[model samples]
Target: MARFFAAIGLLNLVIFSTSFLAAEEEVMTNSWHVIFKRDVDHQTAHDVANRNGFLMIMPMLGSKREYHFMHPQVKSNRKKRSIRHTKNLKLDPLIATAVQQAGYKRSKRGFKPLKSLLDEEKPIESINAFPPKKGSNEEDPLFDKEWYIKNTGQAGGVPGLDLNAEAAWAKGYTGKNITTAIMDDGVDYMHPDLFDNFNAEASFDFSSNDNFPYPRYTDDWFNSHGTRCAGEIAAKRNNGICGVGVAYNSKIAGLRMLDQPYMTDLIEASSMSHRPDLIDIYSASWGPTDDGKTVDGPRNATMRAIVKGVNEGRNGLGSIYVWASGDGGPSDDCNCDGYAASMWTISINSATNDGRTASYDESCSSTLASTFSNGKPGYKDAGVATTDLYGKCTTKHSGTSAAAPEAAGVFALALEANRKLTWRDVQHLTVLTSKRNHLEDPTAHHQWTMNGAGLEFNHLFGYGVLDAGDMVDLAKDWKTVPERFHCTAGTVKGVYKFDSKNALKLQIDTDGCRGKKNQVNYLEHVQSFITLNSTRRGDVTIYLTSPMNTTSLILSRRPNDDDNKDGFNKWPFMTTHSWAENPRGKWILFVTFSSESEEFQSGNLFEWTLMLHGTQKSPYTSQTSPLIHNTKSKLALVKRQHERAAEFQF
Candidate 1:
């Protein structure tokens, strides 16, 4: 049965209604005054930026489209906001309190304001002040227009979501009919490589209500950030300039959710754009900060809206929201932000390459970590190559913000590979199809440090940094069950085989939470997470017991998304198996064999099995996965080893 909302079409979701929101339209006009696009009963929020208080900084939202950036005052000092007795600085009480709670010390609070309040050091630096063209001194070709794809990973900076990754994923798609939206800063509307895939029709600016989202004279000019981010995710390859994007065939749309004071405004606009026929995913690389036990600012309003949209879903439009964690990492303690912790959207953390481990990483204390870089360690070894802003990208940009766009670009490719993949499916596949699991395997060069968050969905790397080949392959066989998964790289090994009539079934079904102390999946399984845990304490594990020696399992429960843990994916727990935290005894396992196994290979017998971790209960499907797919996608798989392996083979 299909239940639909009548008053507001399919997406008639009730966003947080403020007592004054209905009247906001009449009061909020522009140019001089501002409006409260949403309501604030008695909790959570601020009215508006002080008049002339609006400052244009880097889009908290990130991008990788071929950006034409300004010197963007790399002078920013990301810190915990605080209220202190100082002649030079001042802080908003609520935001400062939030920062303190988020864990940042009061003194650690401060960022170069976009504009000068009183002649203090500001964030914007004149273009002429740009560091002398010190490019080419390094090895990355992304900085050299003269170089072709050579500058990519192999050249030390892997071009994100570019041609090679796309070829395998873009089999039948051109991204024509599909439009992917990014919730970031502004786009480089003038970039040649991005214009083709750019969808102005599907784009909007939440940062500014004036309809114009391009960069301005404000401290955050050089609209290139959004463009660069977009380019990395979906730039038109084969255009013959420098390089390509992940979803070269998919249409790219932008929603300027950053660079402004009112995230509520951005959220409202994002909600209104929830049309079934218009967009696909909304990618954002911005999030709340991570403090050991403090919150420096209010939760993101746009993020709040994203949660609503996730719960309410789009106009059956199949759109998902993607966000980035913060970058105060290598600090040994991860302090990612709010959106990444929120279950409403999929959060992305950053990884470095070219030889160094994933940089831009947060302390292990954060969630949703991963890797994606213009150039890092291993580039010299992996032979991977990429295109980049070509500006002075010498410094490593490690933050959740950097990580968000990486995931978003990969997601764009997923959409290009299969336009039908809904928000839920996208998140599911990403977690299941990630590549970090192999690092834990005996055969791989397991540099445990590269594995952020420690294990699976730890605060560091969310579901392990991405793997392009695996993601593309996942998209190819996503809708179908997988059989005989070869040592395929980058994705979970859920290779399904089809019967003559095309009936479908999975090869793995392991319970999600086997044991528990609280909401967290612990230092291990956290890497695979896209959603936060029910509880925030103790521990939870989702592993299959190798046959021969198996017994009782553990099921853990904790607090909901309300406020248990810091930096957790805020949504409910979801699993590949339809089984819930408690899979009833109705579960079983079977094993069949075949002669051959390949991508298009046929005639392979399969194995089906189930193992309960905790207790038994009806409707065991993961609370999270179902919400995204509107259904359950879990099963069981066992190899000749009789090893109770997972479906999301990494």
Candidate 2:
């Protein structure tokens, strides 16, 4: 690990853009981050930064005191500073110097060290796009071509393993009154099939800070990805253009954030919370690079945004977040992704048209369910058909990226069936209505394990393909789940060192969960925060076993990942494999290094923490403030209508 670090500098604040805007006077624009020592008063820190130079201040979402400050670019007179571009200047040295000159002394309890610094970290994004097959020029043309919607055994697909969207539409649960925000590149809302269902008020362009979240002229390569994804959710029905969406009556919006040159954590947070009150679900088809390497997740601000949205969005019912597990089947594991592995989000994987798992799916316990997307490689099966940019239609959408929106669309139908369902209720319905043993692909794994709750789940298929009809039907009579309950095993502070060929095992007993104020019998999601030192991160694999003997392979070896630039730094590994498992008894975590790998011979498990999320037997008033929107989603519709009315009068 030390050698790897010497080879690659720390993965900290990275400057991707060549240009930064600065004004002559009154500070037009500046980008810098400050993390004060613990116990620093918020007002004092803000005043200090302002006195130095930072004028625009915003609190970092996750941290209690960390603040991100920016200076505006004024057009008029400005005093000159040596640092002209925010990207070039490292603010830490200047801030430290300024504080020292001001005779600011460190707190007695605070150790002597540099606590504040610039936040410049950037995250990588990989998009999913497959070659599209041209559709026929006929009425309701592409409907028959969309095997993912209704297989009919077309192109080697199974007859009934599709999402059953046709049956869902037959029941009149077409996602009415539901709005989904696609957090990706951009959506071609003007496309004929998407224009009618587009919701402008629910959309925003975080990259450009504009109201219209459409693809710009600079980047055509990535623009169509979001549009195709949106088409899978709410393309206009009977449009005579493209295939119908799973939830044809649902409203779709776009939050353009990923197409920019630099994808900073701050920008991602803005996108994650864009009009959460108006949008029911935030669909994300993009994540860290799927190169069978990089292990990364949302930074502080983004993490805070996700938590905030799930707790407060939808007028307090909570916003539903849908994430693609990943497309790195050959090597990567979805557990490495913080977003998909989070308990607050629904992680979805892709299945082929024939009901088989996609070849590129990264199997992990974090995945909750599967949905139809593209077909297996070297096979004649067809991929999904949906609208694209330039006012056209295509059938090339594939990958888990394509599968997540399909799941989101199903949830939209469920939401339409029962508007009062909370985010947790949506997850329950997903687990309940998902079908097992539906895929017919010969190459895919077919193993199924019956969980303690009598529900069967497979890592490859994630409780099997989503059943749109069944989900909506269940939603019709779904009772709101009891309030969420959590239990924690205090931090393990010891460093257990080990060499190759030996496994490190640690156990914790719940004692019928007496420690928890609320008794928990079943589990929803389990998370482990681990800090480790490994010679080769790619050679490490971790597993968690529940008392029921269900073992989840949470961290798989990634051969391409050689550097631990961040050294595990309390990284979290989560699993949904324990759903409905007895929360009492013993839970074990096993960490191991591959003996077969001669290079990775040694490592140390520095620290670990365990957390459990589920429900109690009886309902109690939730400590979390109820976020129920008194007016509900209808408020957004009314606003949209008013905007259209004002536009028409002019």
- Per lDDT, the best of the predicted structures is 2
Prediction 1 global C-alpha lDDT: 0.36
Q: What's the number of clashes in each of the models? A: 127, 17
lDDT of 1 by residue, 107-188 (tens): 1111223352224321122122122243312221232321112223344544442223434453544344556676666665
TM-scores, each model vs. reference: 0.50, 0.76
TM-score of 2: 0.76
Worst 10 residues of 2 by lDDT: 101-110
Q: Quantify all predictions' global Cα lDDT against the true fold.
A: 0.36, 0.68
Any runs in candidate 2 off by more than 4 Å, and if so which?
A: 1-138, 218-220, 378-381, 440-446, 564-566, 595-600, 618-650
- Residue 13 of model 2: what lDDT? 17
- What is model 1's C-alpha RMSD? 17.2
Q: Candidate 1, residue 180: CA error in Å?
A: 2.3
lDDT of 2 at 57: 46
Q: Output the worst ten-in-a-row residue range by lDDT, candidate 1.
A: 482-491
